[model samples]
Target chain A: MDLDFTPGEDTFRAEARAWLAAHVPATALPSLETAEGFAAHRDWERELSGARWSVVSWPEEYGGRGASILRWLVFEEEYYAANAPGRVSQNGINLLAPTLFEHGTDEQRARILPAMASGATIWAQAWSEPEAGSDLASLRSTATRADGGWLLNGQKTWSSRAAFADRAFGLFRSDPAADRPHRGLTYLMFALDAPGVTVRPIGRLDGKPAFAELFLDDVFVPDEDIIGAPGQGWRVAMSTAGNERGLTLRSPGRFLAAADRLTALWRERADPHDTALRDRVADAVIGARAYRLFTFTNASRLAEGGDIGAESSLNKVFWSELDIRLHETALDLLGSDGELADGDDGGGWAEGYVFSLAGPIYAGTNEIQRDIIAERLLGLPKGRR
Target chain B: MRFLLDAEQTAFVRTLDQLLAAADTPAVVRAWSAGDHGPGRALWERLAGTGVFALAVPEEYDGLGPLPVELAAAFVELGRHAVPGPLAETIAVCALLRGLGDRGPAKEWLPRIASGEVLVTLAPAGSYALDADAADAVFHVVADGLALATGHGPVRASLDPARRLARPTGGEPLMSGPAVRDAVREAADWASFATAAQSLGTGLALVEQTVAYVKQRTQFGTAIGGFQAVKHQLANALLGLEFARPLLYGAAVALAGGSPGAGRDIAAAKVACGEAAYAAARTALQLHGAIGYTAEYDLSLWIGKATALRTAWGTPAECRARVLAG
Candidate 1:
């Protein structure tokens, strides 16, 4: 019920604010999906790792302060408010790392985490296939035994950042004849530059290679690279999916920063007579604040040893849609100039609008998130999956 | 930096919920809507026995509070039961009296209010006093001040039959000045905060009732809840309601902390929670199809109450303006 940050937390916020103010780039980097932008963001991530700010909540042995989630939240708020760089290592730090922390071996953690934290090796998700978007359990990707490793061969489409990422992780059907579609799968990580691996960058609506398709042909993945036990991929992957849908993937601070920028945009460019747009601007701010407050509550629960399960679906539906609305409000304020590629400084409102278009579709579509919320959270009768 | 309710607040909410659960609130609501306040008044006294109304009055006044968090939680339960009365108005009036500081008026009325011996309501300068005929005292709310006004006109029907509004006139200014202006603003914020909590509670009820309905009311050979279309709409409604919750509690926290920006936080909560509740009402009605339209159905009481609470303290447009102004 209390909302006051502790003195230590206040000091932490001050330290974070100072560090971000000093180190964040003077100008925004290019979109991470682009080649040059990808490299620049990787450098930014390295700098963050140098300061141990890249993963503040991880144990210190793994290059983090082992900060509490509350501290992590404060750091995020500071990071975003300072207009810091977009996280290039998020697929590793946010999605994969949590699963790793849960299921990866100590060897895996010691080896993979520091590199991932330093952005020496960026990671991408290879979960979806052309035929397995929402129904991902039905994916046809397979992995079979090899002399010293597992050989993977299948196609994974809509692999985010695979165009430039160093490695990718996904579930492979290790025992294809298992009774259930979700069973018998194994989660594995493979280097994208392996001899039998190919990445085909696909252009998004704005003609950017925001995501890519992957073709794996006997790409050798070591047995040690597997996450969790064999045939338990479904459970392990669900944890990653939970992290992706919940707090880490889209922190409330990001939206709060966007909301602030949207308000600034409105104050600068909006027509005086546009009351409708004015109300919408206000709503976007409120929505962002609500999301931030909501996440704080969830983090508090987590701090108290509570788990966020199906409720993550609610977060997925909320923040993704709120991101879209906040961006849309900015575009509405921009009016005709919203179409320009770099209208709001180098932040790229038009590009952001185009990117926000994917919010509902990614990290599992909003439709699927809604179904999860309904059946699991609300106790609604299970419908067709 | 915790945002979940404390044990005391949780216990208070649970008590209020159990009391309302056994109060036969639907019967009280129907009786009040039909212009019979006997049952509703009795329900209010029983709720008062739980120290519900006393949560708003300051501790110096033989009451437990100015405890905004506890009060908000209690009002949520009241709204969940569709309790028909000026629930927010009474709390807001107590806030206004507290904002006036140590005064004869606060001492005189605060004890009666906390004990449920009197039902007091207030009306903005041009607006109407809710439940005018039932109120023992009506405070007139001006732009920057307040008064113990009298001479209430006949009760006028609102969209909510139980929410009978009447214009109270012949004001006797009890407070005026810069401090009163701040007090007046505080009163509005409290009203809006509590109303938003009520709105959220109402929405939760609507969605819960609808969830139960869709599970049983079958069509086309299966439970309609089995349809993706129905499930998605309810999910969206639940999303709105769930996210709105933290904002409401956050506003309560801001108020408890005496933060200067509590007004802005309250307005933000008012807009978000109120809209979420209203949207839930729309979804509830649409999902229930024709059956939800009947006034006889218990759901209609919540349906009507949600809309009333939305504009009771501050309309969406006004609240949004407050938020943007900050």
Candidate 2:
């Protein structure tokens, strides 16, 4: 099969390369978990929106360039190659945005998408409760019918970006009388600052308030905030989870860029030929390249009108593991400085290493992903609960 | 950019799979290991009749064009059956002969190889020559050129009895100089690339076999496949094979397209496939428990081949170094 980009795609790459070269910040933004860093990243998102670089795959009416998946991949390559800041609006743009486009009504789409794209409303996902992390179907959150709306009552822990987010979206049991674990659930969006809502920030492994505990006590949500049909929240939320695991949420460009930095670090080290470390560095690079090719294949399939399927679980497991290995190799090469969060040389491998530890746990745990692969892809018998 | 096999390539692989299935590969492998190469030879002739042996031979040599992708596709099926021969090395030798450019030995050997009248095997500079005892000719690869073996020396048994390695003595310098050196390097890449493909094929075979076994074999009043631990282990092995398969195909494309990163890409494929296959072997044997360890069981053919191929063209460490070096 052909691996060369088309002329039009090459032109898109050139344009992306040129824009990224001119627009990437000279200095890295601070950690997005902090207030100052969050504001800075939010401003950066607005800047990207101003240039219509915020979402290249969205339709033109949704403030995107209507770029095909291949072009979007090219855009991602250039985006990460330039070492641009991570998207602070990922929850809104990557996860919830797809759901909104797929399941939201015209009124909700028109009301929420532009603001979300412009970074005027940063979104967080409230999927997991303290007792319902991997077993999301066991969530006890409820949405009781109110006057012309629903009243949400639940506590969601480990809601990423909720510490500083303006809005949150999640699934709630709308029909309490339903028997099935996943039945009668409804997906809803609500302002985090509503009257009965309270957000207590949860400190991450790096001691940053990147996630939070979201408590809702009879919080009122308008009828228009419902996404898809009530009692079909399970189906709607599955779409968002698919996006989380697919090429949209975690692009290969992120790993490619990390690989380049890791290679450079290895090349610059005193013993560039350390046998053990060299093998690992090579593995990281190979893993990254494999992932890049894999994404391109997926992009090609999508371009041919193929649906995104269970393969995203495969991608999630691979990249999350690759992230840890690349970071681990970099830390090993750093030697003494690796243990320090901030060295005199300004290295932050320690912080990154800690962050990488969460990759296998987030989105969906690797254990759950493995089960999905076995039961779905391999046609293996379902494991007993 | 498309990274998948086209319709023709897909059909080619499907046809090869059907052919291998009809060949009763397990019986052939069993016969071959008992020191009877008759069944293996018949299977080779059948494959040759299908132009499998001629894929990498040049057109002028009365064969198919030197197509690396086609060779990769063929070898994957050969590997899936754990075919008992140096097929990868033979195809690589064909490419080297075609690439030797109008030399006397090239003309003399090309036709014989294309017709499947003679078998060829190769040993890289530092590796033992596989199938040397059975091959009509052996190419002793050197850094600067190839030294053709006039006679095979003593054969040594390997962990996989189906694969026999030998020392090639009486090396007569066949080709030398820069072009030949480049040809040798390209041949090595093809060799590594084919090994990777074979590893992936064998890995898939192991997983498939284990999947069938776990579904039927009951333990503690239930099929072990229903256990979470067993399911997770098998799933992880499947992940390894699935991820590595694309890399193998991508490396095939890169080599065919003459990409600048072809060397590193091939090496990357080699390492990924090697590790993936090894992981599959481990899980298969572990899940199969005692049966997987027995030599009489058919599972040993794939398990042994997986271990042997993991270090064939290059060890995973060596392949990894090549990746980093590039």
Candidate 3:
């Protein structure tokens, strides 16, 4: 396969890079801590949307530039190179938008797509129950039939962005008479401000509440809130999960920016005499490059409307592991300062390192990705369950 | 720029795969391993006649023109077959000579290299210090000036029996100055890429052989491949190959395109391929049971080639150090 971008795509990249340089402010970049940081990150997302630069591969009607995947990749590369803030609406832009496009009704699309495109509303996923981390099908969240709608009751832990999100989409057991647990599932969406819903921030080891625990007791979801059908929650959930597993979570531009920062950091701080550390930095740079190529390949395929299948699992694992390793290399280079916290006496390597530990845990654990590769890609037999 | 292979390159890859498949089967590898150098001279002659060596050489240099990525893709198939010989080295030498703009030796040597009449190996391993007694010629690049060892005495050195390693005995100076340093570094980079490509092939072959053996060999009335431990090990070997393949291809492309990032890419590819090939070979040997330990089996030969190639251009640690230094 070829790795070179086309001339047209290169021009697009240059244009995108120029725009980012002109418009993306230095102060808008996000730190891993602080609500203000996330707010600035969201503001940048809106800025990108306003420039018609966000979601470059989305259809023109959906506020995208209707660019080719190669162009989209170029845009992403330039965006990351610009060190733009993380997209605050990434969960919606990456996961829910695709789902809505595929499964949402006309009115639903009319209402949600624009808001998502403009970054007017933030979305979060309420998927994992406390008892059903990897075993997602065992989710005990229940939804009962009610007057012209449904009443929901469940607790979703690790609900990333739940505390700040305007809305959440998740699966609920909707049919009490269904024999199979999966058969009773239904996909539902609700405002986070629904009367019976409560969001509790969960402070991670990194001392950031990037995730929350959502408790739902008789939360009302209108009939229109059901994405597909009464018994279609599993399918809808799978669609979202597939998107999450594949393209939505990954951003090549983002990692490239990190790689650039990492390279500059190493060049400035690392002693060339410490050959081992130098080598590790070299590896990190290479990994970042490879990761970008891999993502770009998949992006092109997606643009061509081709299915990525189990390969995205492999990509997810590669990038997550690479990000963790790159940050670890940074920490190693920092030596004593690596242990300092964000507000501590030293620099923020300690905080970055702590946050990096989540790379393998969030999205989906690397272990789970391996299992997917083995079972789905390699045709290996499923584990005991 | 596109990341997918263009039509011509795809066709080139298909042709290379077909040629390797027909000519470099496991049986052929077994026979070659049974013989010296792990490749028949006639087979080498056939490949040379196909202009494989001239791929990276400039057309004016009596070469097929530059196609580093094409050469890389072809090597992947060669790696798949575990074909043993110095295909990578010859191509690398052609590229190196081309980079040096010294077509005289290339014009003299490339046709012979293409015809499988002569074999050349680069001596970058002991670049810092040259032994003047063993090599027919020495190409040296340093900050002060470049020098060639001439009219030196013979010397002994330990080398992999499968491939020859010689010290400088004597030769006239080819080229010297700061300009040659770029060429020298480019040559080193090409050599690293070649080693990485060959190691990838060796590792892939090891995985294939190991997987096949595990599937056929049975324990407790069940095939060992059916065992989770066996499956996991085979999977791990496959993982190593997977992780290395893209990096190798990326480096090849970078070098082929003559990108500013070539050095870092080559270093990364060398480290990844070296580690992957070594680990895969070890696991493959371990999974082959007792037969893997025996010379009768080709696994040992593949293992030797992998080990030799891993350390041939540069050690993994050295490559990694160079990459980080950038």
Candidate 4:
């Protein structure tokens, strides 16, 4: 397999590098937890959209360069390596946008995508509930048919970015008459500011309102907002879940950049006595590099027209675990200073370590991921209920 | 650019899988452990006929291709089947001969090796010579260069009985120039890369075997594979094995590409494969219960092999140091 980028890809990388060097904010953008920080992140997304850097992989008609997956990966490498602000529009751009492209009608795409791309309408995933987590099919959220639209009633917890998002997308039980557990589920999108909708921010371990509980009481969601046919939400949401596991949601560039930073940190504090720590540090780098190479293989396969299936579960299990280990190693390197929350004194390590904890829990817990890997990837017998 | 194997490479792997599948690898391994190298030797001849041994030899030397990536590919299958021989050492020796360019010694051994006329194994400077008694030629690896040793001292028993190691008794210095230094380094890297691939293959075998076993082996009137704990353990083992695979393949790519990070990548692959295979061995044995520990059981072969190969080329500590140095 060829590892070197082609001339076109290299040129794209050069262009991306040049643009990021000139435009990326020298200082970190404000955190997306607070109101001010959330607005600042949205503004950053707008700036990226203005420069057409927000969605390089999207089609030109959708305000992107229509770059290949390889170019998108290159863009990501440059983006993360530059330590630019995290994408505040990721829930819209990565998770929902793809579903919209695959399942939405032409009219829906024309009306929704440009706004989502421009960061005018931030999106949050309303998937998991307090009752329905790893077993998403057991969700109690319901949507009853109305005159022209549907009346939605649901409580979606752990909705990331819902605290400040403009809209929410998820599955609703649309046909109560269906006998099967997963039957009659329909994917729907609704504005968070719609009447009878409420978003209550949930404080995270880092004391940030990064996620929220979305409560919907007869929220009117138009028929046009339903992604794909009713009673087929499970199939549609599975695609979004795959995106959550694969490159779109968790790009290898993020881990690689963190690895580079970890190596740099090790170089500064290189001590021969801590052989255990050194080996662990090396392992962390190895895990990150392995992930980068693994993604390249996946991207190459996709380029060759291969479908990504349960293998995404393996990726999710690996990277989520590695992210936690990488951050934990950084904290170990910082010693007592790792607990500090101050901006200085390497407190970012503490913040990162805490955030890494959510990796396994979100996008499907590692436990659920393991089950998928076992049952689907390994072709094992179904686990007894 | 493609990072996964192309069509030809995929076909090559499939061919090797077919051959190994029909070879009764466990019986060959058992016979080799009993010092009956006949079956193992026959398998080696078949592998050579497939040009597995010649994949890394120079094209001019009657070889199909001359890339460490090919060697890595073949060795993964060899490891999967627990192919008994110094297959990795033979390929690495071929790489060393190629690295020596068109020198007289390389020309003398290159064609023979490519045609499977001679069997070569390596002893890296301070380590014992592997397959010393059976080897047609043994390369005495020094810090600076290599010497052709014709004799070997007392054979030492290996944890994995299929492999026999001994001290080199006599050495005839074959190469020692500056170019030879680079060749020696290339040889070391090949050894590490090949060994890593083997570990990956072995881990995969163990995971597959264990998954099959857990599906049938039941407890409390339910298959153990249905148990969440068993499922998670096997999944974790598979995760380790799967993740290590990219590192092994990437190491091949880096070495073939001659990237500046080749050494570090190879070392990283070595550590990752070594650890992953060892973890798989642990999981396999634990999940298999007492049956896995039995000598008569086939799982014992892979278990012993994984334990031995994990530290064969270099210990995890040494590989980590090489990685950290880069």
Candidate 5:
């Protein structure tokens, strides 16, 4: 199996690289260090969308070029290569669009797809409840049938990006009497501006309000706002989870880009005698390269229209672990300098390390992913519920 | 970018798996542990007849051109059967000889190796202490001297008794100097990749065996596999195998493609696979619950081999250091 892109693809890569070089101005988006900084980062998303370069994998109807997955991978490589600003509407573009494509009705898609594509709207996930963290099906959020729709009344804690989101998609228990807890759930969407909805920012240990606590008190959602058939929230959630594996998370090329930066950072200050630091840097590079190969293998499979099963779990685990390790190594290489915050008159290594801490916790925590691997991939006996 | 084996390779793996399964049973493993390496010799010959050993050797040396992935796949099968032989060493040595611009040694050894007539083991110094006891001739690096051993002799070792270890005395120097150093380093990288492939196979086999045993062996009125602790251990073993497999393939691909990062990647693969295989075997033994520790069972043999092989070319720490040393 060939790992190198075809000549045409390589030429395409060059063109993309040149275009990004010429058009995209280098802008450092706000580090997730402050609320105001993050809010300012939203403009970066609009700029990228205006260039038709926001999310390259979406179909042409969604403002993407309808490129193949491999090309999308190439675009990712170039995007990170240019050190482009992080997309503020990442949740909307990466998560909700894929969900809408798979489960949204035609009218629903027509309304949400363009706004999501153009960065006119931002979305947040309202999935986990106070009682349900890893055990997501145990969520206590309830939606009662109202006049023309459902009224959502519950709390969703650790709702990432909810404080500034325009809308949110949540899993609510629609039928309390259903046989299975999972069977009673329904996926519903509602505007954050709806009456009786309150979003309170939750400050993390890193002092960033990138996450929020959403309190829904009789917030009305139109019947059309329901994503799929009733009692299909679990299925809809699975599609969203699958998208997280495929497009929402850091692509393999993105890992390579991070590796290159880490390598350069290490080399600039590396002491030739410090063999241990050198070794860590080398591992970071190697890990990044292996990750790229794994991703490209997946991309090639997708290009051939092959179904990727539990193997994507393996990828998620690898990349998340690698990202954490690489950033940790970066901190170690910086020594005391690594502990300095972004504005602490030292390098950005410390801030980067702090950010890396969230890798394992986000996107269905690595522990749950391990459980998936154990049960689904290895066919091990199920754990006690 | 492709992750699948070609049809012929797939079929070949199937046949190899069957042969290994039938011939390398626990009884055979026990017998071999008593120092009989002859039981699997015929199967080795059959595999050689299929040109498994000739995969990485060039056509000019009476061998197949470089097929690192195919070679890796073959080693995986060997691991599945827990086959006891110097298959990896033979391929590694042949590749090294070919790299030295001396087709003479490779030409002399290829047909015999392919036909399983003469078994050639790798004797690179510093990586694994060469056992002069089992050597017809030893190839080694010495500071201003050459060494070789002609016959069997006494050597001290911890595991894998079927493969003895001994120190070689003086012999003729095959190649040396800066150019040979470069070639030797390149060969060592390939050797690391091959060992990693073998480790991946062994690790996978250990997981499969442990999972099967835990599912059947009852304890406390139920299968012990039903326990979360047992399940997590097996799951961790599976994780180790999954993580290492891709690194092995990536290293092989980089080496085959002559990429700039091949050396670092190979070292990483070696370190990862070494740790993975050791953990897998250790967990397998722990889960097998005393049966694995008995000399009559093959699990101990496989564990011993994994422990020995992981330390052979280089320790995981050493490989990790190499990768980090850039």
Candidate 6:
């Protein structure tokens, strides 16, 4: 089997490399969880969209280059190699955009995608509630029939991006009396600043407002904002979950970049006799490379028209674990200085370490992902969820 | 870029699997372990007819390839079946001979190896080759000083009875130069790569068997596989194997492409697949409880091989150290 990139892909890589080298900011932006950083990152998104670099795999009408997955991979490697800013619009562009393309109407795509791409309207996910987490189907959020659409009423905790986002999308109980918990639900989008809506920021482990509790009371949403048919919310949302767990949400480029930095960090300041830590660093590098190759294999499979299923759980578990190991190794190499929340000595690692902690918890917890792998991918007996 | 076996290779695998499946592999393994080489040797020749051994020899040696990808696929099936003999050693010896450019030995053994007429084993970086008595030729591997063993030592016991280890007591100098060093390194990489593939296959087989066993073997009035505890363990095993797979294929690709980093990549795969297979075996034995522990049970065959594979070509620590150095 051939594993080398094609000439066209190589050319795409060159062009992306050139653009990123020229445009990437000289210094890192403040944490995206903070308001000032949020605005700054949104501006970065605009800059990327201006050049159609924000969503390379999307159609041109949606401010993308319509690049193939392999080319997108090339662009990702270039983007991370250039140390580009984290995508502030990841939720919309990576998560919501895919679903919009798959299940949303053409009108919805035209109305929502361009804005999402340009960061004119940042989107949050409002799926989990206080009671529903691994068991997401048990969410209590409800949508009642309104004069022209639906009025949402419920609390969505740990809603990513909701603290400062302009709009949000999630599942709501459209037919509460349905026989099954997953049935008769509706996926809808609504303005976050609507009359009866409220967003209460919640500080993450690193003390940043990365997530929020979204409270919707009579939050009116237009009929056009609904995605797919009423009872199809579970199916539609599950599709997005796959995207979140798979390559789009956590591309190998980020880990590759982190790996490179870890290697450089080891070379720069690590003790010569710390063979154990050195091995750890090497392992992180190997793990990152393995994930990168595995992703390209998946991209090839997808390009060849293969369907994605529970296999994303494998990707989710691996990268989430890799993220933690990488940051931890970098921290260990920095010794006590690594513990600093911020500074040039070991700056960004503490934040990275804290962020990696969320990997196993979000986009479905690792526990849940493992269960999926066993029952679905491994063809294990149907286990009690 | 395609990261999968092409149509011809896929068909090759299908044919090999059918031949292997129809053969009573367990009986052959048992017979070989009992020092009856008749069935195992016959099976080997049939496998050679499918060009399994030919993949190791150079094209000029009346063989098809040094095709790493196809070799990786073929060896995985062999491991899945838990075939007995010095398989990886034989392939590594071919690589060694090809590198030797020793006209006498190359002409004498390469064609024979490709035809499955003789089994040549190499003990490079090690003191002994498994099944040395059964092998037609055994080479004592030394950097810049390669030699053919004049005679074999008494058979030594191992943790697994199936692995019959013996050292070479005397040697006939075959080659002595710097090319031998390079050849030794390349052959070691091939051995590691093939062993890694074997470990991956054995682990996969163990996991698949465990899953089937758990599905039917009930506890608490329900199938044990339905338990989350069992499911989670099996899931972790699957994850280890699944992720290890890409590394194996990537290592194969690197070897085939002649990448300078091929040694380091193969070492990484050796660590991953070896550990994955070892972990799968542990989980299988634990999950199967008493049945897995019994030698009479077929599970012991794979379980024993999985354990040996962890330290066969290189231990995890050594592999990880290589990774660090790289």
- Candidate order (lDDT): 1, 6, 4, 2, 5, 3
Over the stretch A1-385, how does candidate 2's per-residue lDDT look in tens digits?
7688989989999988898899999888888888988999999999998989899888888789999888888899899989898888999998899999999999988889888888999999999998898999889999999999999998998999999989999999899889998899999999999999999999998789989999999999999999999899999999989989988888888889889888888888839557888888888898888898888788888878887778999989999999999898888898877777753353556767787899999999999998888878877888675
TM-score of candidate 4 against the unseen true structure: 0.97
CA error at residue A166 for candidate 2, angstroms? 0.6
Per-residue lDDT, model 4, residue B23, is: 95
lDDT of 3 by residue, B182-293 (tens): 6677777787887788788788878777766876787787766666666666566666667677777787677776688888788788888878888888888788878998
Each prediction's Cα RMSD? Answer: 1.4, 1.6, 4.1, 1.5, 2.7, 1.3
lDDT for model 5, please: 0.74
Report the C-alpha lDDT of model 1 over A1-385, residue by residue, as the tens digit.
7888899999999999999999999888888879999999999999999999999999998889999998998899999999998898998999999999999999999999999989999999999998899999999999998987899998999988999999999999999899999999999999999999999999999888988999999999989999999889999999999999988888888888989988888888888678899899998999999999999889989989999999999998898888888888887777777778853453478887888889899998999999999999889998775
Each prediction's whole-model lDDT (CA): 0.89, 0.86, 0.71, 0.87, 0.74, 0.89
lDDT of 3 by residue, A1-385 (tens): 5576668877888889889889978553445245777677677767888988877878887788878766766777787777666677888888888888889998988788777877778888888999988777788999899999999998999987776778998888888678876788998889999999999988878667888899999999989988898988888777777777676577666667777777787887888788777767777777776677666556656656678887777777777777788888877777777777655343445665676778777667767776666556555555442
Worst ten in a row by lDDT for model 1 chain B: B141-150
Cα lDDT tens digits for candidate 5, B1-326: 46655678789888878776776455555544455556655666777777778787777766785788787788877766666656566666666677766556667766666666766665666434343443334555555222333433455555764445655545567666665666666666777777788788888888887878887888787878767778777767776677677778777777778899887777888877878899999999999978998865767777876777797666776787777555
DockQ of each: 0.87, 0.79, 0.36, 0.80, 0.46, 0.76
TM-score of chain A of each: 0.98, 0.98, 0.92, 0.98, 0.95, 0.98
**Sliding window of 10 residues with minimal summed lDDT for model 6 chain B:** B119-128
- What tens-digit string does per-residue lDDT give for candidate 2 at B51-114? 8877877777778867767877877788888988888798778768767764677778877787
Model 1 DockQ reads 0.87
Q: For model 5, how does the per-residue alpha-carbon lDDT over A1-385 read when each residue is reduced to its tens digit?
A: 5566778779878887987888665555567435675566666666666777776777777777777778878888898878766666777777778888889988998889878877678888888888998789988889899998999998998888887778888799998898887888999999988998999988776777778899999999889999898788999988888778654477777778878888888778778778777777777776776677667667767767886777767767777888888888887777777777766344455666666677778778877776677677777666563
lDDT of 4 by residue, B1-326 (tens): 88888788889999999999999999999998887878877888888888987887878878866676777777888888888888778877877887884468777887888787788898888788788787889998765778888788888888777888888867767767888878877887888888998988888899989999999998999889988888888899989988998898898888787789988999999999989999999999999999998989999889888898999887899999888897
The C-alpha interface RMSD of every prediction is 0.9, 1.2, 3.2, 1.2, 2.6, 1.4
Q: Residue A330 lDDT in model 2?
A: 89
Q: Give the per-residue lDDT of model 6 (tens digit) for A1-385.
A: 8789888889889999999999999988888888999999999999999988999999998889989998898888889989898888899988899999999899999999999989999999999999999999999999999988999999999988888899999999999899999998999998889999989999998779999998889999989999999878999999999999988998999999999999889988898788788778878987988898889789888988996788899999999999999999888888879899875567589888999999999999999998899889877777677
Best by DockQ: 1
